[model samples]
Target chain A: GAGVSQSPSNKVTEKGKDVELRCDPISGHTALYWYRQSLGQGLEFLIYFQGNSAPDKSGLPSDRFSAERTGGSVSTLTIQRTQQEDSAVYLCASSLVGSQGNYEQYFGPGTRLTVT
Target chain B: SQQGEEDPQALSIQEGENATMNCSYKTSINNLQWYRQNSGRGLVHLILIRSNEREKHSGRLRVTLDTSKKSSSLLITASRAADTASYFCATAITGRRALTFGSGTRLQVQP
Candidate 1:
């Protein structure tokens, strides 16, 4: 089966520029999530979408960061006016929401965003 | 804030030796999961242990969860050089869908 996939394996941009990263979750997956990982650091949750309900935005570091999942399939994360601090590997993952409490997540290769 | 914190930021061992990594979380969790990442790209799921599970085994991997102590441990027996990678522990909070991951342990296995 096809796993999650992300576009633009690597991106380099200047500070204050905007960038959009895309993710395609596995077919039939209802939950999608985005996370950021800085060099030698842990993953920081960004946002999550489940079914048609409201997306969880608690983890978004600032207003400049936003994400939207359309048709319950693909998701895009947009960073407006990016900052040097925003440079990191953006990872996307998807999983099936099961009756059980927790489910393992399948990840994408990720897009490394470099803000120079 | 990060919930899970893995001990020993890095580790090195010889092939065929056993390796163990530990993780500690701050809050109650529904499950704990281990993931392996190669070259800092995609992460592959290794195992998952529910809050009620105290120990689970898959192949040469053993995972133990202690809800009382808010900690978990992953033991890999008879490791191989190919096992060298970054291992991370992630916690699914009691009511949260998103997972909180630890900084990870960089494992180096010499053949």
Candidate 2:
């Protein structure tokens, strides 16, 4: 793709249900990131994936949150037992390899996840 | 603490007026960048300034950096209604490859 792409622009889910947000990064991009933004708020870091290696899941916020990246190109953010506090716009971004290369991050339109 | 923090969480000005937003970070960085996000839309990269560079300009955007203070400012000249958006500052530290973003400033331009 010419830029990063995300699915389900908006999702309304019930509490305790699990939801998966997908991210398809630009072709050849080596680093992918997930961020969450509340209404009128700044981005909250969620996860970072580089290549096929382990991801920096430090920002997942809790045990209910998890993510996976396949083939180093596509990534998914999964939130289990969704809570109202989890409602936010989940954004995906891609950039050239961080340590190995450098470029501005290309962001996706994001999926607005609402937990009711 | 988050590496970057934006000042003046919100700003409102008449169209054609200039807008200036400032950001302060806590750690040494490899580079600092700016981005703008319209309501409910994806963020658009604005400009990036390296640690060694003091200033940069592109189109109507002007950015100034002070490494000693770990601060940066973005100035938009002759701002227009189209510039009404939330602005954010992000920094990628020398050791941390992922960019850390600030809370952001919401700028409103009224005609």
Candidate 3:
């Protein structure tokens, strides 16, 4: 069984440019999440999508950060006008069922975004 | 901001020794999970302890949760060099899909 997978292992772009990171969750897993990890820091929640319910975007730091999960399987995180502060590892995770009691999340290798 | 805080930010020990890391949280949780990360990449799920359970064991890993104290501990026994990595504790509160994670404990197992 394939675990969660992310695209573009490493990406370096100008601070003003936009970057899109992609994630493919495991089959039959209806819950997907995005997180950001800065240098020597812990994981920060970004967004969460469970089934057809409205996605939880409260963890998004700013309006510049946005994410979308199409067909309830693949998710794309878009950062507009990236700042140097946006440089960090973007990780995606998925779980079997997103119920409140479910705690296991399989994570992807992550996409390292570097805003130069 | 993280809801959990892990003590002893970093640790170094011999391969055959045991390593213990503690975590404290500030809110009620349905479950607590432990994850391991290598080279700052994706996290590998190690163990999950439900709120009702005080202790759980998997292989050489032991996890304990004390809802009354809002704290938990992860112990790795007879660690090997391959066990060297950053370990984090995440809390899943009731009704929330996203987890709150602690900074993590960096453990180095010297062979």
The lDDT leader among the candidates is 3
Who wins the TM-score comparison?
A: 3
- What does candidate 3's lDDT look like per residue over A11-58, in tens digits? 999989999999999999999999999988899999999999999999
Residue A82, candidate 2: C-alpha displacement in angstroms: 0.9
**How much does candidate 2 score in TM-score?**
0.96
Considering chain A alone, what is the TM-score of candidate 2? 0.94
Candidate 3: residue B13 Cα off by (Å): 0.4
Error at B101, model 2, angstroms:
0.7
Query: What does candidate 2's lDDT look like per residue over A39-100, in tens digits?
Result: 87778888888887788888889999999998888888999999999999999999988672
* Each prediction's TM-score versus the true structure: 0.97, 0.96, 0.98
Better of 1 and 2 by DockQ: 1
Docking class of 2: medium
Q: Residue by residue across B1-111, what tens digits does model 2's lDDT show?
A: 668999889999999899999999998888899999988669999998998999999999999999999899999999999999999999988766578889999999998
Q: After superposition, how far is residue B79 of candidate 1 from its true place, in Å?
A: 0.7
